[model samples]
Target: MTTEMSGADILIQALNDQGVEVVFGYPGGAVLPIYDALFNQQRIKHILVRQEGGAAHAAEGYARSTGKPGVVLVTSGPGATNAITGIADAMMDSIPMVVITGQVGTPLIGSDAFQECDTVGITRHVTKHNYLVKDPAKLGDIIHEAFHIATSGRPGPVVIDLPKDVQVATAPYRRTNTSALPHRGYKPAIKGDLTAIEQAIELLSKAERPMIYTGGGIINSGPAASMVLRELVKLTGAPVTSTLMGLGALPASSPQWLGMLGMHGTYEANMAMNQCDVMLCLGARFDDRVTGRLDAFSPHSKKIHVDIDRGSINKIVRVDVPIIGDVGRVLEDMVKLWKAREYQPRDLKPWWNTIKTWRDRNCLAYPASVESGEIVPQHAIRKLWEATHRQQPIITTEVGQHQMWAAQHFDFESPNKWLTSGGLGTMGYGLPAAIGAQLGNPKALVIDIAGEASIQMNIQEMGTATQYRLPVKVFILNNEYMGMVRQWQDLTYGGRYSSSYSDSLPDFVRLAEAYGWKGIRIERPDQLEQGIADMLAHDGPVMVDCMVAKMANCFPMIPSGASHTDMILDPAQVSGVMDDEAKALV
Candidate 1:
């Protein structure tokens, strides 16, 4: 059964064995053989991106949406260099991605050879791990290991640098398929810590006011643990709060949901964290953004940190009970123990009522425009949600005020349903990501809620969506400025408003039209619902330019590096500021 094959063929075979149905990449001289071999492989589809960076981001988007390792293939030198930003973006966000780049032949590695760069060294800091394939025989093993490493242990990008000679070298090929991967430095905790779990349960049973703070780890660990957390909350009657990464884990409208708790979080959620006696931190990190003024953060609460990574426990805030294990496994064990012990806390209705009163008094406040002539960003998101409510669509966003508005206003009913650039805060992320997500779930409705400034970063991907004819609806919140930074300056920095305007902005409708795609512009509020409906009804790619107020700001503001409890409900005052009418003119 031994058959000789080139490194490129082995690589393609490995990918096919891994169930990879698609790849995003660009062709170059060193990588021509790989692309040539890819031509016959009908099982895998290759998406040629306009830029190498777009390829990388598109791969990341595919991975994030599909829960599989996204693969990117690019050439050496400038091609590899162009992909660095996207690699770093994936690394910062902890997304599972594999980047395969062509390198100069082995002999030319250090001879100042043309199109030769130390891609492995350049990407070391960003990737979870990397490899240089000197031997064609080892290509399959390297690819298999890369997928395992990228998808496991917190999930991140992994790189494989392939030399041109190696791609042409011939070797016997054999596919390896298994449930486990061999990595010496990579080991994830899968078993729960029984002693710590029992202690955590005991603490919750004894506490008068208890709350669960969760994060994205819950989503990555899958829905089993998330369900357990919900059941435990219902059984114990403990209020639940989540960070931005953890929003979709608990239903937004649930009675026990206390809203997002951190900077820019609801006042009641922050107050609950400060006032609660016990905080059961599940699959969440004590990020500075979430725990502002750490010295004063949850000062009254006894924190029980449950995380899969041992290092994450006590990395920031100290923990009374540190349980190290997979979030899903730990939650399952805790649930079993709770059922056996039959432990329950007394009535929390009084405490829940108090929290509700605070929430009702000061809901996430946004000014209602009396003019009502133009379409607002919030209204666009609301209508989009309405249009896709029955389908339970997956919403992704680029990083900006529109992203924040979507986070605050969109009611996410399921876990992992909302994908965005959270930790990395990468701009130009939405469009390609939506395309990837649409590819992942062809039957589901996938939309990218993007801003004018952020959308331009990856607008070239419009062709990618069109080529695939992916039914990805792009709702461009065209405010004609970097809305978030501008909002800060207008409020805190004397309204300087430097470099935030796009006076010469391109007409997005026409820009989209240039790509031979359907484009619509919504100027008035009345056109909102119909526009969204029209987009949903269409069969192919479309972009809707939603003209929103340029000066609108994301509310329930928490100033940077400030305590969560010390949030500013209103915009900061500017000295000698003009009245609303006068400010509108500026």
Candidate 2:
């Protein structure tokens, strides 16, 4: 004997049981029953997004910032299809999310009825797991399990396809025990092997040139991991460099930090990566962007990799010691072992001196001042950082040259504050991500550093901001082109910028005003500071169209198939077109 409840009601109760307070979603015919259930209850709040894609990105931002699994709901057919990008984005970046999509009634699922689709079939590759529920009794357990799987080992998005009839059906609602999820085979390694940890420590202790290469894994492990990493860096006195996703793991202002390492990475960081005798990789897979040419990547170094996922270890670059466990715990073990042995690392002053010489190149150097009426994008980013760093703002970015510039200029002091699309390089991630970030951290300043072309991908989300009264800022670096595409075209295709030019652009200020938000336009160098000041002063959503130079390309670029040392630092060095083979490497 049990209390019977509608599948829709059970779904809501299950979400409540899992501690989900907010869901980003859009309603439609197939999901009417669920939406009606949502209307009757106040325990869970729903954010009505302009588009399904925006909902997914907003959930991603919320999850990335809060370290909680983001929730999403959308109707069947196009609604489910529209969220593909965001789901894939979560999969690539390893975000925790549970997306519930409505489907046609069970009888209609295979009959090609109106708005019918094979939701689970389509999302299988992009999700950690998926479910198509025909039975209402099993729905509650599946929902609970979805959340557990999403938030568990090497977190990622999970999809649940609920048919309209199933949602309307009645069933006995028994809340599942979240801690004792039925997926017993999915346990992830937490504590590392102590012997392997001791061996890694012993190797590092004798190394004359040791380097720490960490990535998003530490950030995903929670803030404590970052703290342990900082302590470990201090004890060993090793130079540090991070991938784009791993930026905030170590404070950018730390003396040992050499800045981000990769295609658009700092010269000093890349140089150190190339020259280090001992490399300790924590929670980072050696992505192509970071490794450059695999054959030439850190050839002489004895590598050590620590990661929670066994599959990620030695998947790309083989390491001498592979410690499979949570990055934070592995680091803690290493710290304890080093202290117990009283190990002291050899002098690395010579290595530091060599790194200093690379830093002296000032590869990021660009004209700080452009004459009135023109802005350099890099300078604009630096100025944005200058004004907002004191507040320790949460910064988000759309994928493009502006994203790289923000990574270069914005010094993140802690984990979970910087949000951007790293693995997927999805455009239009910034504005909506800022919306979620602002809502999650109501008192904190959340800004999206967007490129002109990329912002248009989801500019409609400003309406979502206005409706919610979120004071999220959109700072568009108006370069009048798809900056990265144009850069790649210039490098690999003989500067034939075919479709890269942004033509017929809308008046962003007017668009902002029409959306019931304040707008600012900065066309000159003199107005930069005050414009930013005015934007921050406004208590509502604001859009700043900061006009920047069109032809300025991002520098310190390692051409496809080039080694870490073979980077082009200036426009003058960009010459020659690559063949078809070279074009595919990047």
Candidate 3:
């Protein structure tokens, strides 16, 4: 049954029918009608964020954590502009999200009216699909289509621009459940070609040195895909390595697990990737960070790539076999075909033995905080893991050294447990992501492992947590500098120390108090564990400022444009103006 309703009411009804439980947004004059519709809604809780960008990120966090397309609502002009960063971040990382923004009424739209800009034009490139609803009857259909496209195939952000006049205009509201969304232009491949799947299996069966290289797509495919991946790994007896975003796709404790692979990947993981004779590429695209010096990478390997998006195939390095399908389905077929054929893997014992030798390098080994009085950021992350005693504690991270350290030290045993800005490397990602994760899994212990400089980018999110009485914890590794930037300047730029230092930083403890939360500061290694414990034990939001070793650098780094073999393995090799070690080197 169709009913005549205002466009604003129709949007709310569409949201209710789509099972939208919450919306993170900031209101402005242009979106007054939508806000009026949302004002007294009980079915969908509205979270008022401090900034429009924060709303988009929080929505992304909710989607990545819950595997549901996140929804964001904002007003025109500046509100829409502020959200571009999050939209681009989601688009790059393939996080599914729908952002709805208000535009000036149809008559005012091209006249440069108050708070009017080209909302559609500004977001068109950043979104997978965008709609500027000119017709009243098309509003609900466009919203439904936006959701479908945003969550379908290689999931990404979608934008819907609602004109103020349209909101007041009457439209016929129809339930999306009864009517299928009309989308003829976009059809994504879901099942792989049978011939290609068989060919990939045969290629894997014959290869002696096989390694699985996967990325965020596996995580995005949900737990079922992760299970199938495990089955395939078990059947083949091959080693598994993942991109930074693919951390929790397989158990970190699994025997075949090589820690995260790529720029800051473990030595064993990168070494195995370079030496593999058959690269079984999974849901991951060969990102530049993962594939350094592409020509030199696995030069001897016959690469078999399986991805749902056909465009990603042969887009970077060409593959010997390309299988287009959902990773879960392809992996299931691979496992079934292997069983049906009674296939035996080519003896990979020699390859495993070589990987064991690389593991002996102890690439991740770092001194304990007790050995050095100063708190090591690595040790602090390790302590957080111990304090949680979790194989998969939901963790979000801001981009930088802390992000890498969290990936290395924490054991994410399943998908959706780890969330961070991988492709775009957004600085202010973690806090809002943590908030969204907390809302998604209300009972889970959600923490944002952040660097001081990066965390400050979205520190305002603390208000959102406190207001909602969420127990999300913000664990800051305070180095008083943009650690990664400083590390690069120290290494590549001859330690010029150009503006990298974060001087006169705010008093985090007092800042947390100002925002209505508990705050703890730990400067010494001995105080670190207790600080985290107390922060975790607290029932509400808590911020921990752990002043870590000032000069410590994240290691096992594949220097930019360098081959996997050319990594500067540890902090000892790094020299700086303030370092006595540099003086000794001179």
Candidate 4:
């Protein structure tokens, strides 16, 4: 039986059919009808964010932590524009998300009428796929299709521009049992070529020095992929290193783990990549940060790249064998084929010895307490990990030195427990993402390990946490500088500090009080442990500001345009200011 309802109601019904429990958004004139429809329903709860940008980031946090597509709703014009940053962030990191933006009536779309703008046109590049709904009858189908595209095959944000007229128009809507609207041309490959899997196994078996480079694709493939990844590591006995976005895909406690590999990666991980004979790249693209100088990156290796997106394979660094299929599926096939042959794990004693020598450098070691009693950022991150790691907290971070420090120091034992702005490196992503993560995992510990400068980007989101009574914590490593920018200025611009100094910072304790959150400020090194305890003991949201060293710079860094081997291990290793050519590289 076909039931007649307004497009707004049909949208709500479609969302219900898709089993959407929560939506992060802000309501406005264009979305009034949709909001009205939302108000009438009890099944879907809408979280009202202070800004449209927060909504998108919160959705990102929710999606990344939950392994489900995050949903967003906002009005037209500025509302849609505000969400572009989060959408771009999700697209770059391959997060599954669906955003519905309310547009002006169909006739007003191109007229610049009131709040109307080119929503579809503006979001086309950021989204995996997008749709502009002119017909009310097609609304449900489009909604279903949007979710399908957003969640499947290299997951990313998808936008649906809904006009006011379409929202008000009546249509015959039929409830469908299936959540996805099938598209014949959009089927993504799931299984890998058997021959290629066999070839990968053969190369891995013969190699004396082997490295397994994994990334976010394994995390996106769910817990099963991580399990298979562990099994594969056991069979191959190869050292494993992951990208920034790929943290937590494998247990850090594992002996085969080599930590993250990139510009700011560990010494052992980077050295392993540089010296490997056979490099098995799984679900990780060789981005500039990871590859350093492309020509010098893993030059001695026979690379085998496995990725679901064919576009990602050989995009930056060409591989000897390219297996285009789902990472988890391909890994399963490889595991079965290898076990069927009863292949013994390779002898890697010499390789392990070399890696251990690199590890002896203690690249991550930092002063626990300075002569001035100021906190070291690296030490603070390590202490923070020690305090909360037992609880298995979900940690999110804003971009900068604090972010890299957290990535290096904080160990993740399971997947989905660590979320951060990896690709876009958005400054204000952590606070709102923490909010989203907390809401999605109500009982679990959720913390935003933020920097003083970056935390202020969406500090207003503290109010959202207070309103919901969420116990999300914000641990701010206060150094009074946009740390990464300052570091870059030192290296690229000869220590001439520019606008990176955050002199006009707010009193975070008072700011937290104003937002109805518990606040704590730890200035001395002795106060760090107790302050963390109090924040964790709080029943509601708490924000902690831990003052740290000001002039600290992250190490084991491959300077821009330099190879993995050309790393600056410490401040003394920095010879002079870099040239314009090196400064141009990120």
Give the whole-model CA lDDT for all candidates, comma-separated. 0.83, 0.92, 0.89, 0.92
What is the C-alpha lDDT profile of model 4 across 1-586, one tens digit per residue? 5778999999999999888988999999999999999999899989999898999999999999999889999999999999999999999999999999999999887998998889899999999999999999999888888888898888999999999999999998876544345687787778999999999999998899999999999998888998999999999999999999999988999998989999999999999999999999999989898999888998899999999999998799989999988899999999999999887767889989999999998887776686448888888888889999999999999999999999999999999999999889999999999999998999999999999999988888888898888899999999999999999888888888989999989999988988889899999888888898899899899989889999999987999999999988999888658878888877
Can you list the residue pairs that collide in candidate 2? none
- Worst 10-residue lDDT window for candidate 2 reads 367-376
User: What is candidate 1's local distance difference test score?
Assistant: 0.83
Give the Å error, residue 421, model 2: 0.4
Candidate 3 on 1-586: residue-level lDDT in tens? 5668988998998988888998999999889999999986789999988888999999999999999988999999999999999999999899999998998999999999999999999998898989999877988888888888888889999999999999999978877642365566778788899999999999999999999998898887778999999999999999999998888888988999999988889999889989899999999999888887676777889999999899899999899999998888889899999999999998889999999999999999998777438888999999999888563569999999999999999888888999999999999999999998888889989999999999989889899998889889999999988999988888766878889999889999999999999999998988877898899889999999999988788889876666677666887765443344422321
Local lDDT at 410 for model 4: 99
- List the candidates' TM-scores in order: 0.94, 0.99, 0.97, 0.99
Candidate 3, position 98, lDDT: 91
1-586 per-residue lDDT for model 1 (tens digits): 5988999999999999889988999999889889999997798999888888888888877876667888999999999998988899888667889899999999889887989899999999988889999999889888998888888767789999999999999998877654555676677778777998999999898888898998888877777767887888778889899987787788887888878877667888888998899999988888876887677788888999988778788998999999887787888888888889998787787888888877885757665533447666777788788878778888889987898888878888777677888777888888888877888788888889998889888899898887888878889899888998788677656778899886677888898889877888887788887888888888887889999887777767656545667766765422324345433422
Give the candidate number with the greatest lDDT: 2
User: What range of 10 consecutive residues in model 1 has the weakest lDDT sum?
Assistant: 573-582
Regions of model 2 farther than 4 Å from truth = none
Give lDDT: candidate 4, residue 354: 94
Cα lDDT of model 2 by residue, 30-55, tens digit:
99999999999998979999999999
